[model samples]
Target: PDMRAAEDAGARNAQLTKPPGALGRLEEVAIWYASWRGDPRPRIERPQVVVFAGNHGVTARGVSAFPAEVTAQMVGNFRAGGAAINQLAQAAGARMDVVALDLDRPTADFTEEPAMSEDEVVAALAAGWQAVDPEADLLVAGEMGIGNTTSAAALAAALFGGAGGDWVGRGTGVDDAGLARKAAVVDEGLALHPQAKDDPLEALRRLGGRELAAMAGALAAARAHRIPALLDGFICTAAAAVLEKASPGALDHCLAGHLSAEGAHGRLLQALGKAPLLDLGLRLGEGSGAALAMQVLKGALACHSGMSTFAEAGVSGG
Candidate 1:
């Protein structure tokens, strides 16, 4: 981040017509965005939303209510602009891209073995990194993969030293029995892949699905290019957590877009110290929540850049 730009934006915010802190977190959001964009008064001209889809072998363990085929079907829906993310992104004036990663070959069932080998994980990460647009000022990453919430839970438990029951949630509207089975599957994967607990990237490879790994890579790319990111729900947050665990402060350029209905999502956000911008009971995996939050960011920038200063408006005691 550009410290000079941040200071400039903060000074401008103080001079705005609004009373101090009247805008609340929106003021902070604008300044943070300015720092990443290297412009004291930045405008969100082009926001990009990427949704990566992959199938998970863990679905074979009945971890999710939906079938693995839904991953591919949803990818088709995304391409046809029929998914919720497509509508949200369109409303936000964002360009949307959907990448499906080897849907025909799902990851190995994590309960029985590592989800992905080193080469496979690397390839998935590269796909994510390459999917990012260099010209995009803002980025939002989403995911589509059946049983991926189990992968996310295992990854979180491995990274943060928690039990499976602590991180597991009822993904895809699974029943109580299915939820318990998901928890057991998570514990089994953790027990089988003990080495992942010591290595963050290894945890992603062993316990995360391709779309999750891709989301991690996309966020890393956003950080590298100095583009601010809006993080989605549990699966997306779990992916972002891998980057943070590998390198502290890796998520400094990112913001939690919203709080999802997923049981463990709030706990994960608390762990990351990210206060979400919205809480609409959203649990949809498509970048719908983040895309919706893009409008909030746009509103912040609009007010920050378009509002006149007290001096310009010839007002006193602004």
Candidate 2:
């Protein structure tokens, strides 16, 4: 972050027409954005939303209420502009891209063995890294994959030191029996991949899916380019968590976009020390929550860059 730009933006905020601290978090949002953007007054002219889809072999365990085919089907929905993320991204004037990562070849079931080999995981990461647009001012990475929530829970538990029951949730509306099965699967994976606790990247390779790895890659690329990102729900946050666990402060450029209805999402955010921008009970991942939160960013930037200072308006200084 550019401390000089942040200082300038903070000073400008005090000079704005409104009373000091009137805008609350919006003021802080603008200043934070300015620091990353290196612009005392910045506008989000090019926001990009990339949704990556992949199939997870763990679906064979009946972890999700939906079948694995839904992953590919949803990618079609995204391309047709019929998904919730498409609408939200359009509403925010964000350029949307959907990448299907070898939908036919899902990751191995982590409960039985490592989810992906080193080569496969690296390929998935490369797909995500290449999907990012360096010119984009902001980024939101979303995922679509059957049983991915299971993968996410496993990754979270591995990186954060938790048991299966602590991280498992009813992903895709799984019933009680299915949820129990999912928890068992997570515990089994944890036992099989004990080394994941010490190596965050290994946790991703051993327990995460292609789409999850891709989200990690995309966020890393965003950080490299100094593009601020809005993180989505449990699955997305779990992917970002791996990056942070691997390298402290990896998520300094990201904001929690929302708190999802998923039971473990708030816990994950708390662990990451992120205060979400919204709480809309959203669990429909595909970057929908983050895309909606982008409007809040736009409003903040608008107020920061468009509003006149009291002096500029010839108003009396308070």
Q: lDDT for each of the candidates?
A: 0.94, 0.94
The 10-residue segment of model 2 with minimum total lDDT is 54-63
Q: Count the backbone clashes (under 3 Å) in each candidate.
A: 0, 0
Candidate 2: segments with Cα more than 4 A from true spot: none
Backbone steric clashes in candidate 2, count = 0
TM-score of 2: 0.99
RMSD of 2: 0.7
Stretches of model 1 off by over 4 angstroms after superposition: none
Expressed as tens digits, the lDDT of each residue in 1-318 for candidate 2 is 999999999999999999899999999999999999999999999999999998888888889999899898999999999999999999999999999999999999898889999999999999999999999999999999989999999999998888889998887798899989989999999999999999999999999999999999999999989899999999999999999998889999999999998859999999999999999988989999999999999999999999999999998877
For model 1 the local lDDT of residue 247 reads 93
TM-score of each: 0.99, 0.99
Please give the lDDT score at residue 22 for candidate 1: 98
